[model samples]
Target: MPSPMVSIINVSKRFGALQALDEVSLEIPRGAVQCIIGPSGSGKSTLLRCINQLEPTDSGAIFLEDELLGFERKGDKLLELSEGQIAGQRMKTGTVFQRFNLFQHMTARENIVEGPLRVLNRPRGEVMDEAVALLERVGLADKSGAYPAELSGGQQQRVAIARALAMRPKLLLFDEPTSALDPELVGEVLAVMHDLASTGMTMIVVTHELAFARDAASNVVFMDRGRIVEQGLPTTILTEPTEQRTRDFIGAER
Candidate 1:
């Protein structure tokens, strides 16, 4: 079998007195969508952050496409890479947060173009073309010239998705992609995500949207108190979870 697209091994993270992640290990194969669901402070978001080294793992390691991320392995020793090297490895994973963290001063088109031009150092003309195409893909072609102030919460989030996509990341991490949107606006953003998933993008989503998780996820993981309670195919996990915590959590959500 081909290697998993993302391999996280015995990962643990702590913040002073509180442990955020506890001996977590997971493997996401290429083109798979894994949805992580649980209550607040379950460390779902922290796990996503660790994947890209946004929050460093206190122990263990994360890899992308067989490459050791954020560190180099010499025999049994793992040495942290330089900031420059870490930044390069991080580019392989794109992240979309609960908040649409856009630059208020830049237009949607400019926001989408900024990364490829500044980080990737692609030619301006090529980046502009790709940015425009991405805007169209996200159903925001008309809003390309619009500033963040002029867009709805859903629209801005869609633009954020487009911006992340412009980087052509190997893996996408979404942390509650719809949590901040108004109820009426959530579907639009979810629709874009559904379409993206259909196209076989490798994604790891942290969300509470059970319907989306059931409909679009290849696998579902139930996490609580910084540990995975259970995980399996979405149908099995959602319909017939064996763990009492998983069943109770799903029941409470319902």
Candidate 2:
């Protein structure tokens, strides 16, 4: 078997009295799509945040490829990296949030190229071309000149996806990418993601879309109450879940 591209080892996190993640461990391979599915407040989003280091883990470790994320081992201690260092590490992973966090004033093309120009310091001409290509990839080439307010919810989210791709991340994290979309617009967004999966883009998606998981995911993870209750091949987890909680969740959704 190939080595994992991302690993979470004994990861636990807390916010006040709530344990957002409890000793969760997962290995995500390169060129694989892993979908995390569960009810609300099940720590699905928290886990994604931890992977991107948006949420500092209370214990355990996360690794991307061979490198530790967010912290550095020094002698016998694990010390948090400086803000600058963390930013450098975070550049390898791109996250699309539940809310389409696009800049209201910037056009789609500008939003897509902002990161490369500001953080990577690439030539504007080069970044702009790549940005346009990314917009095209997300099926929004004609909407490149539109600002956030000028686009539909689905269109804005597609632009957000394009902005993340502009970074050329090794791993892409999607947190309920279509949750805010109109029912009619959801398919277009999922189609783009399905296309990405088909092209072997390594992705970890937190979604309620079982059809997407069933058809696109290489693995399905069923999480509840900040812990993984059951996980396996999508066919098994979605069709023949071993745990009652998984069955209940799927049953309720259906």
Off by over 4 Å in 1: none
**Would you list the clashing residue pairs of candidate 1?**
none
Per-model lDDT? 0.93, 0.94
What's the lDDT for residue 150 in model 1? 96
Best by lDDT: 2
For residues 1-254, what per-residue lDDT tens digits would candidate 2 score against the true structure? 76688999999999999999999999999998999999999999999999999989999999999999999999988999999999999999989988989999899999999999999999999998898789889988899899999999999989998898899999999999998889999999999899989988899999999999999999999999999999999999999999999999999998
How far off is residue 57 in model 1, in Å?
Answer: 0.2
Distance from true location, Cα of 200 in model 1, Å: 0.9
Model 1 lDDT tens row, 1-254: 99999998999999988888999999999999999999999999999989988998999888898898888988989888999999998888888989989889999999999889999999999999998899999999899999999999999999999999999998999999999999999999999999999999999999989999999999999998789889999999998999998998999988
Locate the minimum summed-lDDT window of 10 residues in model 2. Answer: 1-10
